[model samples]
Target chain A: MAKHVLRVVAVVYVLFLLVLPVALIVWRTFGDGLAPFAEALTSPSALHAFTVTLTVAGWAVLANTVFGVGAALLLVRHEFPGKRLLGAFIDLPMAVSPVVVGLALILVYGRFSPLGGLLESWGIQVIFSTPGMVLATVFVSLPLVVRAVVPVLEELGDEQEQAAHTLGASRLQSFVRITLPGIRWALGYGVVLCLARSLGEYGAVAVVSGRLVDQTQTLTLFVEERFQNFDQPAAFAAATALALIAVVTLLFTKLLRPKDRSDGN
Target chain B: MAIEVRDVNKSFGTTPVLHDVSLDVAAGSLTALLGPSGGGKSTLLRVIAGLERPDTGTVRISGVDATRLSPQRRNVGFVFQHYAAFKHLTVFRNVAFGLEIRKRPKDEIRKRVMELLELVHLEKLADRYPSQLSGGQRQRMALARALAVEPQVLLLDEPFGALDAQVRKELRTWLRRLHDEVHVTTVFVTHDQEEAIEVADTIVVLAGGEVVQAGSPGEVYDNPANPFVMRFLGPVTEIGGSLVRPHDIEISPDPVEGGSPAVVSRVVRLGFEVRVEVEIGGHEAWVQVTREQADRLGLGPGDTVHLRPAPGARSLVLAL
Candidate 1:
């Protein structure tokens, strides 16, 4: 009787924490006879939101990939003063709220700021625009890629690269042919995480995106807007699309996970 | 080409790793840098290969001033203790890597890689990655990869240090034969005396980041540079303020001219010979005698025996 009660309690916790939320979301998405889902997929506003979200997330991931790998290499291979402090700062984004990231960007890019005036004088808008969305996404998702990659790079010693150098390969050749392949799996996983985090980001993007419908709104913002307007079917449909993307990304990540030792060779 | 290292010094933080070390390696000969652990043998090899730069002085290879050149420009090949094979590449590709980087033709690379694989007797396993190979096989692959580039100088940093005893023995003989065939100026780092004596044309004994002695294997064995080399090389027993190798001492029952009489402390059967420990002048010394000698002397653990220092011993006297 005691074992049965323990089992019941454990299952009840799981149901409340996981299964119930998923079921509620799925049921809400399907309640409108599939017409609302079709409309949401073809709507101009929905299409614009999808495009903006993808473009910002893609740009943010591209920037982070280059910078993250560079930072990882620096942290792993070389030593300088305050290196640990720099590493800690990289993880600062993970601890802060996304809304605070947006607010910080606003402070730096607002019209009255020095850089913001220089950009405005050149007729280049940054705040409350598509670029601001990218800035916010980068700020919030910076740690995801770096944290995923630094440990792998550190574990990989310089022996192989030095071996290549002694074998008469130039510095660039050694890096491209040997070092890149050694860290490719980790870099790929970091990219995926950066993409996922950027796609789902809300608070920072919300503050900076300015809720400009059909202009700078992202999929997450579109879902929130539809739900607040009592358009439950459209909101659920958009959220379901995001859920599909996340599932596919997760499956790809699983496949990319480092293989067991025996099967790798 | 000959390698001449002059007044080389290196330091890791404040701890000195190499201290004003200089050595000459004649071209087309296999040399062994023999030393105990933490003796800076590997550091010297790295300096020679241009993998680690010396804090001061110069390294010249083939009479060329190569002190400032990087490892790639130095045209050296190194085999690490851990094999250091590219785990992602196949055996054939790993061998072809140096050639491929040189932009060799595909057909030439294939032919050369196949030849190297056959040289190491791993041609059948050419497609296998390093992770799929046995420890001994992976070491052979590492050798093939290093040999693929036809390096002007080859540096091996404890190449067989990771192998099992049986495998190490087999590889050592094979390596000696391969060195004979290649005839490259090679320096192999090893702390194992037997391996160095068996494989190297010249043995450079290092101790405490300095060269203690350099000579032919038999020369060093017969006459050590100092007590350190003697103790490092073979079993040593001290007698009358001097250390003596067990095999060098002679034992006799009858008192002979120019010999010391001592009591036998113990007899140890060492498969090849019986090691007889004798106490002479308040110091204990070991003497190796054959079964015939033991029988003739009627020697056992608690008997009296006469000992003598063999002539032509003390080939090299090291500063204390």
Candidate 2:
């Protein structure tokens, strides 16, 4: 009886905390009609905001994939001085608040900073630009891929790679043929996590984007702008779209990622 | 190819793993590096395969100095203890991986892979992934994959160490037959004395990062160079000033002149032979007798018996 009551309580908690809110947003989004939602989605600024969000997320995922796999391989395979320090640094983005991460990036790349000023003198702009938003998103999502990949790499020791090398396969050939296939599932899952984190990132992107309309605004920022301007329908519509994307990504990842066999066979 | 390893030494951090180890494996001969755990057998195998670099040594393969060459350039086949097959690939593809990397023609690769699959007797399971195979089957696949590259020297690091007892026995016999058929210069590491004696043409015994003895199986068993080799190969009993093997001791119910009188302390019945423990000269000594002989003698615990070293029995007296 106690177990039954506990299960009921957990279900009710999830329904209230997650299901109800999403249901309310979806109802509010299309409650009046599809006309307002369509109008908000088709608006030039709204379209640009979605475009910027996706572009920045795309670039962030790409960069994070390369850097994350490299870092994971290094941490798992090699021993060096300051290796633990480097490992701790990989998790820094996860521990620090995204807003703080944004502030830190600004301090390093702002117009007043030495590197930023030099770039500005060369007719380049990073702060308050698309590149700034990408940098912030990458910083926020950096840990996701590395954390996912490191354990898998550690589980797969150097035996298969060594076998390949002894079998007359070159280093690159061995990695491509043996090592990569062995870790493909982990790498794919890491990429999906990086994409999800990059897509929904708002705190760091908001601080670095400068809230410029149609120029640096993302979907989350656009929703906030609409809500502050008393455009409730537009806000709910944008939120609903973002929620739909997240749900689709979740479902896709669940369906396509390799099954987690406990035996590791 | 003939392998000549000269004065190989290796150390991990501050601890030495391989001492100044030198060995020569003739072409078309199977050599077993037999030792206990952490005895540097695997390290020496890796050094010969070019999977590991000795800190200060030279490795010559087929009369060529291969010390500076990488593993790929050395052209050696190495089988790991755990059967490191590519998990994602089917049996056919796993065996064909080396050929694929070498850019062999597709049909030729297919032909060669199928031939190897037939050789390992896994032709019906060609499309199956490694995860679906049994432990012995997976090891066979690993062997086939190693042989796919047609390497000059074949090195196996305890290839049968991970299998069950029955499967290990079966594979040991199969490996002997395979070596006879292929005749590649093969070097394998194992800690099992019986396996080494059964499969290797030459047995190299290592202990504490040093080679204790290297000789033919019969030579080593019959005439051990030291107490370590004698005790390592089989049970040994020290009588007076010499080491005697258990099989060399003869036990009888009646006391014979000039023979030692002892009390039978224990009797352990093995399948073909019975091991009888007797106290002789205030020391426990083991004597192996056939079951028929034991029954005829009626020897059991707490029985009076006479123990004597058989005539022409080999015994060794070592300094250390």
Candidate 3:
């Protein structure tokens, strides 16, 4: 009897907090027989926003994957000064508000700053551009891969790596052959999460991107602009698309959960 | 190839693990570094394998200085206690790893890997992943994987330490037979005295970061350099500043002349033998006797007896 009550309570809680809001938005999106949904999503500005979101997310996930794997290896495998500090800093983005992150990036890399001026002189723009947007996305999602890979790396000790070394494997060869494959599922899970977060990130990208319509606008920003302009149909359609993407990413994450100890086929 | 270490000293964060240690292993001979845990046995084995560099000494493999060489360049095979099977590869690929790294021909790799798998008796499970194998099977696979490269030297750090006693014994005998057939210069670290005795032709006794004695198994067991090595090898009773093994001391309740008069303090019945601990001249000495002998004597606490060394039995007396 108590178990049934708890189960019903959980169902009700999920219905209100998650399912109801999502279902309403989805219903509102398809209420007009899919015509407005297709027309709003197929617009020039909406399509441009989507490509921009994909571009930023692509670069951010790539950068985060490389940096996260390296940081996890260093944290778990080596001992040095300030290792704990570095680990704690990797988690800073998750703790701090994304808006603050955007402001911090602007403070350091804005056009008037020294480093920004240097980079601008080299014909590379970092602030209020695609580079700044990628930077913000990368900073916000930096800890995902590292957190995913660190525990797995710790559980997987250095014994096999030493064995590989004794078997005459070069350092790169051992990492490519042994270390990377060992962390495949965890890495995939992290990548999926990072992609999800990058696509949905708003405050940080808003501050860093300057919110140029059809230029640096992302799908998320497009939704906000459409809704504020009283174009609720387009806004609801974009929201439903993002919801679909998040659901897909959730499914991927479920499948990529690192439970099985795989040694290849 | 032979191995030589000269005055090797190692310290981890100011704590010395191996100090002034020197050793020499003959070519194609099986050597065991036998000692208690934390006695630097594994550290010394790693030093010779080029996994750990010595602080103030040199390591030579087949006359080549390997002090600064990386393990990859040293070409030594190392096996760990936990059987470091590549969890991402099948048994066949795990055995074929070294050959593949060396980029041998595909056909040759298959033939050599199959040969090693059969040698280790894992050919039937070649397609199985490490996660699907038993602990003993994984360890056997690890050994075959290490031997695949035909390394100049093979080092094992407590290779059977994770297995049960039955499997450990089986692997010990198997290792000896395998060494006889392959004859690669090998050095294994083990804290099991009986294992070192039963498997190794030469035993190097280590204690507290130093090599106390290095000789044949019988020599190290019969003649220990200090109390630590004496106690580390096996159980001994201290009598008048001399250590005598239980089987070395003879107990006679018939008042034998020239023997110390003693009282039987305790009698313990272990498997296959009865241990009679006797107090002799205010010193404790253990004597081993058969069950029938113990029963006939009816020895118990407070019984008077005479204790003396058995004929031709080696007793160790450490100078204080």
Candidate 4:
């Protein structure tokens, strides 16, 4: 009886907090007709925002995937000084607010900072540019891949790798043929999570992007700008697209989850 | 290939796991490192295989110094207790992995893998993944995969420790037959005394990270060098200055003229043999008797009995 009550409460909470908001956005985007929705989607600024979001998120996911796998391997396989410190630092992005992450990046890459000034003089713009947005997205989603891959790597002890080594496989060969294949699912799951988080990230990208009209404004910022300008149709259309991407990513994550092998055939 | 380890010492952090361990395994002989858990038997096997580096020692394979060599270059095959078969690869592909990495011809790789699958009796399930196989079948696959590289020496760390008793017995016989056919120098670690006695041509007994004794099974059983080996090989009772095995003590209801008076403290029936515990000379001693003898005597706990060491029974004199 208590379980049923709890289930109802959970279902109602999800409907009000998640399902209703997304459903309302989709309804509002198509309420007038397909004509307005089409116009909103094909608008130059909307298209540009999408391109910027995808470009920054794509690079961020790729960079985080490589770093995540390497960090997970080091944490699981080796014993070195400051290993615990490294692990703690991996979770910093998760613990800190995304706005704080954006401010931190700005402090490091801002015009006044020596490194930022050097890069600026060399015509390599970081703050208030695409690179800055990418940096913010990477910082916000950095922990996703590492947290996902670490448990799987630790669960798969060094036995298989050692077995490969003893079977006359070199270090690189063992990692490529054995370790990578073993952790492929975890890596994929991490990539999907990082993708989702980076796509939806707002505060960090906002603070770093400087909200340039159509150049640095990502899809989330575009939605905020459209809503502020009282263009509900355009805002809903953009938000619906982001929601669709999130839904697709969630499905992909479910598909990539590791299967339980204990149920014998 | 013959393998040698000299003065090998290994320590994890500040705690020592292996101490001054030395061993020599002959070519094409099956050896067992028999010891209880935490005795460093597995560590010694890994040291010989180059999987674990000893702090101060030399490992040689077929007279080649392998102490500083990596496991990849040592040309050793290691089988883990959990049968670390690749989960994503089919049995056939797994067996072909080593050969494929070595860049062997495709046709040769296929032929070798098929032959190994048949050898391990998994030809019918060659396409199946490790998750689809039974524990025994997975272990057999692990064995076949290790042998695919034709390693000079094979090291197994408690190969059958994770299986049921029935499967363990069957695999033990199968492994012995496999070793006989291949004639590769093999060293396996096991805490089971029966397994070591039955499967190994030579037994190296270890305790507290040290080699207590190494000899043929019969020799170790008959003439254990020290108290640790005697107690480890089987149950033993220290009487006066000698160590006596349970099977060597005779139990009778009638008071023999020269036998010691004792009370039957416990009687345990173990299929063909009955173990009778007797209290004699202010100490407890175990006596093994046949079921028929036990039935004839009709002895139970708290019954009076006489105990005597059988004539010609092997006994080792304790050295202080």
Candidate 5:
């Protein structure tokens, strides 16, 4: 009886807070028999937004994955001074707001600053450009991969790597053959999470991207612009698309990540 | 290859783990580094394997100074206590890893890995992951993987320490047999004195980062260099300010020539043997005798007795 009550409470809470809003948006997306949904998603500006989102997310995930794996390895496998500070800094992006991250990037590289003016004089524009947008997305998604990989790496002590060294494997060969394969599933799960977060990041992207149509606009910024322009169909269609991508990412994460640390795998 | 360490010293941070330790392993001979935990046996083995660098002195493998060599270049096969199996790979791949890194031919690698698996009795489970195997089977595979590299020296750091008593006993016999067949110069670290005595041709007892005694099992057991060595090798009772094994002393009801006065405190019947505890000058000592002898003597608590070294038994008698 208590279980049923708890279940009802959870279901009703989800219905009001999440499911109802998502169901309403999804209903509005397909209400016009799918024509507007298809048309709005394929428009020139909407297509450009899709491409931009993909490009920024791709670069961000790539940078974070490499940096995250290296950081996780250093944090878990070795000891040095300021180790705790570095670990806390890695999770800073998750703690700080995305808007603050964008503002900080702007302050450092906003063309009026010394470094920004120097880079601009060197014919490299950072703020109000794809690079700044990628930086924003990377900052907002920084901790996902590191957080995912650190626990797994910690569980895997250096015993096997030491054994590999004893077996005449060079450090690089041991990492590629033994350590990398050992952390493969966790790394994959981290990468997927980074990808999903990078795709959906909006506030930072909006602040850095300047919201220029068909230029720096991402899917998230494109949805807000369409909604403000009274283009509800296009807005609802893009929102539904983001929701679909997130759902797919959830499924992918479930399949990739081990359910729990059972079977010693 | 024979391993020689000369005046080697090692310390972790400021805590000394090995203090000017030195020993020699004969070519193709099995040596056991036996001691209690934190006795630096494992650290000493790592120094020999080039996994650790000694702060002072030298390590020579086959007459080559290996102190500065990286572990990868040392050609030593190290098997850790927990088996350290590659969890993601099958047994076949794990055994083949060394040969694969050396770029041995595909056919040669297969033949060698299969031969090792057969020797370790894991050929049927070659396709299974390391996690799927029992602990004993996992360590056996670890041994096979270590041997796959054809290392100059095989080092095992408590290879059976993680297993239960039965498995540990079985693996000890199996390792001795395997060493006999392969004739590789192997050094294994274990705290189990029985394992060392039963398996190693030479036993080097370590305590407090120093080599207490290094000799054949019989030599070390029969004649320990110090009290620590004697106590570590077996149960030693302090009597007359000296340490002696329980079996080395005999208790008599009346005083005899060269006998010390004592009083029986307890008679413990242990299986087929009888242990008599006697107090001499306020220090307790254990004396072993046959069951029939104990019955004939009819000793009990508070009974007066005298203690002397058993006939032909070489007891450490500086004071006992």
Candidate 6:
């Protein structure tokens, strides 16, 4: 009887934390009618917001993938002065609040800042623009990919690489053939996490984005604006879209990632 | 090809592992680096293979100065203790890896790989991955892979250490025949004296990062360099008066001085001989007598006997 009660409590705990919130969101999204969902999705503002969000998210994810893999490979394969300090700094953005990321981005790219003013002269405005939003997203989600990859890269010993070299492979050839295949799975996982985090970023991009309708505003900001303006159905529609995208991306990752070797295949 | 290592010194952060270690392996000869674990045998092999750099000295293979060359350019084949097979590749591909990396023609690679597999008698399992093979089969595959490159030198680091006794014995015999067939300069690293004696033309005994002795297997066994080599190489028993082989003492009704009175503790029949354990000076000493001697004397346990060292079998080892 006690064991049964424990199992019930554990399931209830999961439902309270996970299932309940999803259930509430689904209920809220479908509460009104199909017309509200269709109308909200077809709006020019919604379409603009989605396009801007995708452009920013796509750029942020791409930048993070390159920089994160570079950082991870450096931390794993090489030793230099202050290497541990450099590694700790990679995860610094992750530990900080997203709001802090926005603030830092603004401090570095605000109009008063040297680079920002220089870019402004070139008419390439960063702060309060789409570039600012992408920069903020990248800053906030930077360490997610690195953290996912560095440990796996570290666990892979130099033996295979050495064997490749001894087998007459050049350094680049060894890396391309032997080392790359060893870390490809981890790289895929890291990229998925980077994309997901960048797509869902809110506070960082919100602070940097000007929130102008059909301009710098992102899908997340559009949802927030709709909710505040009492456009409840529109807000649910945007939330449902984000949720759908996240679910699909996660499912794709699950399907495509290599099968778990622990399953004894 | 002959490998000449001169004054090779290696230190791991100030703790010297191999100090001025120099050895010569003549062409087409099998030399066994016989030593206890941590005696720098593996380090020396690594130095020769170019996996490790010597602090000072030179490794030359057939007149090529190999000190500055990388492992790949050294043209030396290495078989690791655990086999170190590429877990993902098939046996044929594993053997073909060196040739493939060398950018050899595909037909040549296939022919060479098949020939090596045939040499090891594993041609049928060409398509099977390393994980599917047995331990002995994996070792043979490793050997075949090492041989596939047609290397200038071959180094094996305790190749049969992980196998069962029967498998080890079989492989040791097979390796001796393989060396004759391949006619390559080979160095086998092992702490096992029996394996060294049974496999190699020359046995180099190492202790504390230095070569204590190097000679033919029979010479090293018969005349050890020191007490360390003596005790390390063979099962030694100490009697009260002197160190003697179990076969040195005879069963006779004669009591001699420089000899002692000992009580027979136990009698063990060893088929061809009887080993009699005697308690002398509060310690047990084993004495072996042939079956004829034992039968002539009617000797058994709990019989008091006078122990005398045979002059012919008595040899003194200077204590280190």
**Candidate 3 or 2, higher DockQ:** 3
RMSD, every candidate, angstroms: 2.0, 1.7, 1.6, 2.3, 1.6, 3.4
- Candidate 5: residue A138 Cα off by (Å): 0.8
lDDT of 5 at A259: 42
lDDT tens string, model 2, A111-203? Answer: 999988988899878889988899999998998888878888888888989988987888889888887877777788788878888988999
Q: State the lDDT of candidate 5 residue by residue for B43-112, as single tens digits.
A: 9999988888899989999889998999999998999999889888899999998999999999999999
Model 4 pairs in collision? none
Write the candidate numbers in order of decreasing DockQ: 3, 1, 5, 2, 4, 6
Q: Which DockQ-derived CAPRI band holds candidate 2? A: medium
**TM-score, one value per model:** 0.95, 0.97, 0.97, 0.94, 0.97, 0.87
lDDT of 3 by residue, A30-113 (tens): 999889999999999999999999999999999999999999999999999999999999999999999999999999999999
Candidate 6 chain B minimal-lDDT segment of 10 residues? B311-320
Error of 5 at A191 (Å): 1.0
Candidate 1 chain B: minimum summed lDDT over ten consecutive residues — where? B311-320
> Where's the lowest-lDDT run of ten residues in candidate 3 chain B?
B238-247
Quality of model 4 by C-alpha lDDT: 0.90
Tens-digit lDDT string for candidate 3 (B264-306):
8899999779988778777777888899989988999999988
Per-residue lDDT of model 6, residues A60-174, tens digit only: 8899988987888788888889999997888888789988888888888899999888999999999899889988988888887788778767766776566666666677777
Total backbone collisions for each predicted model = 2, 0, 1, 0, 0, 0
- By lDDT rank, best first, the candidates go 3, 5, 4, 2, 1, 6
lDDT of 1 by residue, B1-320 (tens): 48999999999999898988999999998999999999999999999999899999899999999999999988888999998888778998899999999999999999999998998999999999888899999989988898889988989999999999999999999999998988888999999999999999999998888998989898787778788898888777765456777666767787977778899988887776887878887877788888777767777777887777667545233234
- Candidate 3: TM-score? 0.97
Model 2: per-residue Cα lDDT at residue B193: 98
Candidate 4 TM-score over all chains jointly: 0.94
DockQ of each: 0.70, 0.64, 0.75, 0.58, 0.69, 0.37
| lDDT digits (tens) for residues B55-173 of candidate 4 | 99899999999999999898888899999988878999889988988999999999999999999999999999898899999999999999999999989999999999999999999
DockQ of candidate 2 relative to the true structure: 0.64
Task: Determine which window of 10 residues in candidate 1 chain A has minimal summed lDDT.
Answer: A256-265
Model 4's CAPRI class is: medium
Stretches of candidate 6 off by over 4 Å are: A27-81, A114-126, A129-135, A150-155, A212-215, A252-265, B239-253, B256-262, B268-275, B279-284, B288-314
Question: For residues B1-320, what per-residue lDDT tens digits would candidate 6 score against the true structure?
Answer: 49898998899887899988889888989999999999999999989888889999999998899999998788888888888777657899889988988889999999989999999999999999887889999999998988888889988989999999999999999999999999999999999999999999999998899999999998887677776787777765677645566777654646776677788888788899788888888987788888888788776677777877676664555353
